[model samples]
Target: MERDFKMTAITMAGLEEVLADELRKLGAQNVKEGIRNVSFKGDKGFMYKANIALRTAIRVLKPIKTSKVFDEEDLYEAIQRIKWERYLDVEGTFAIGAVVNSKNFTTNSHYISLKSKDAIADYFMHKYKKRPNVDLKYPDVKIHIHIHKEWLTISLDSSGDSLHKRGYRSATNIAPINEVLAAGLVMLSGYKGDENFIDPMCGSGTILIEAAMIANNIPANINRKHFAFENWKDYDEDLYFVIQDALLKKITSSHFKIMGFDKAPSAIKKAQQNIINANLEEFIGVHHVNFFNSKKEVFGKTTILFNPPYGERLNINVEEFYRKIGDTLKHNYENSTAWLITSDIQALKYVGLRTSKRVPLKNADLDCRFVKYELYEGSKKMKKQIDIGE
Candidate 1:
């Protein structure tokens, strides 16, 4: 590969800038942030590194071609014009996912995917005697179509599954945070291998695992079995191994502790299992205890990041729960910076502590707020003045 081909990365909504900053740190060229996506330039090895290291990206795509399409016929013609034989064999199973945003095209994405699949199958059936099968669960080849108005961009999904499948999480209970979001939260918190970290409300240890990975400089996908590049026609195993070895060599030993506390014993068991699965048992410790009654005693300059249960089921008193969060942090965790994410805006007001930062984020489909509070040992007003050099 010439190392100059353009690549696109898709991310969760409102995380395009986050993904773009990550790519820039990885030395990607011509980085541009779009809505829920980032475009950059890299080679085959860079593609592998991006898959292994990126924390916010969902999938990395290599655009094969971009053109204008008016209807299904145009879509088929464009898909067929790209020599599919170069990328996959007639025996390989494949799947297509389409995203449409056009006024004239009211066709469902599933139908568009089916039409594109037919075009590929027909192309192979006409050229060869056999056609590939479609495997939705796991496919050797995955194609993506993006139609915006009249423009169509067809790309190959280099990340077969979503990047959130970091390969370490086998034990999960209710409300396990997404790996990418967890990593992003750690990044946004500005805790870089310094200070003790605690996810006091850790349900399945997702935040703790992500924090340990960041602190130890481990590759995000170190335990992953396969990347989509491994299935690419031009995959260079030796080059990939070289890159992997180099990345592994950079893994530093972490001395800081990452602790998780969950009130439910079942949640603690799942967290411990997940930590062990990630080979990070030494770095992370999980305890079964209610966070509201717990105090910060992790030693110097602790950073707490947690996601408390936002009452969506309408059974729990959300206002009271949030108020408890404020009381616990203010009374117990002095000299600490605590951050929490919740979708309940009404409940957030109950946590009466002044938020130092209010970051707008989304969890699943729910618009959420990621707020930070600075707990002080004495008067918060005096501490604020001291912090501001007043």
Candidate 2:
């Protein structure tokens, strides 16, 4: 059995707690939350499970070494000291990425990456006659450099591409929510496979797809093109397949419906294509209709989660659009819990509904809030809408 070691699961800024809970549930030991990450310890099989099953994790990194650095030489020497041969061969290709949050670094991420790359190549060249070539796009090894103040940590990225590229989305919108964020929202909204899921402003059906995947307990990265760990020298292909097979056995179908709506023909078409790509056609349906003009498709309780246009990307009047959203929820969607993630705080006031909960989150570079509103069954507005009876 491989020895257990600490690993960090990178996540969206506000989802640290949720991701930590996920790690705990996945059987990680000594789980701890950081700003936009969580740390835990597990063996190789568990690491494979994490990359495959962690819905909120953007990437999982196995820390190989940690050292204090006051300057660039310290960074280079610490990196060179790690036995890179243990993870990658001299002829193999590799890529480096940096996430530096330190004053001592005093350089752009690209510069850090280049320095790390050079250190690795030089280390290999001194030992072996030839050195590994840098393949930025697709590499046999992916290294992550994290610098915090004077501390430098080098890690091996277990998940190659961002896990958000779940190998299912062939189409996207102008500002589609990141899949990791989408999944985190669904998880945070308290949706299990038990309730009906709806996305009114479903741009390309990301929320809907993530909801269905969660509902079915589907492994988050089951459709990923590849995981970087698969290329490691110690990679156990059979062990990985065993983990994948185990995850497959856990999938269970949900009885409730999952649906999406978008007024744009382009969005509707792309959503359908993406939903098909996810193999969730039976559980999800996309329709072409303006959200404000539509009512809840389900009769009983429903959970609606979506990312409406934040107005930064489009020319629409954000305030009025938000008002319509509030009106639609009040009149149309009774007995429902509606949540939306948006960067527009001022526009949120225009919605007019009292937010039951507000979660501060960062979407890409934008500071956003995930707000929730409860629609009571048989409220005055619902009664009025039912009286008018559309």
* Model 1 stretches astray by more than 4 angstroms: 311-314, 384-390
TM-score (C-alpha, index-matched) for candidate 1? 0.96
Model 2's number of clashes is 0
TM-score of each: 0.96, 0.95
lDDT against true structure, model 1:
0.89
Quick one: best lDDT, which candidate?
2
Summarize candidate 1's per-residue lDDT along 117-145 as a digit string, tens digits.
99999999989978999999888888999
lDDT of each: 0.89, 0.91
- Where is the poorest 10-residue window by lDDT in model 2? 378-387
10 residues in a row with least lDDT, candidate 1? 310-319
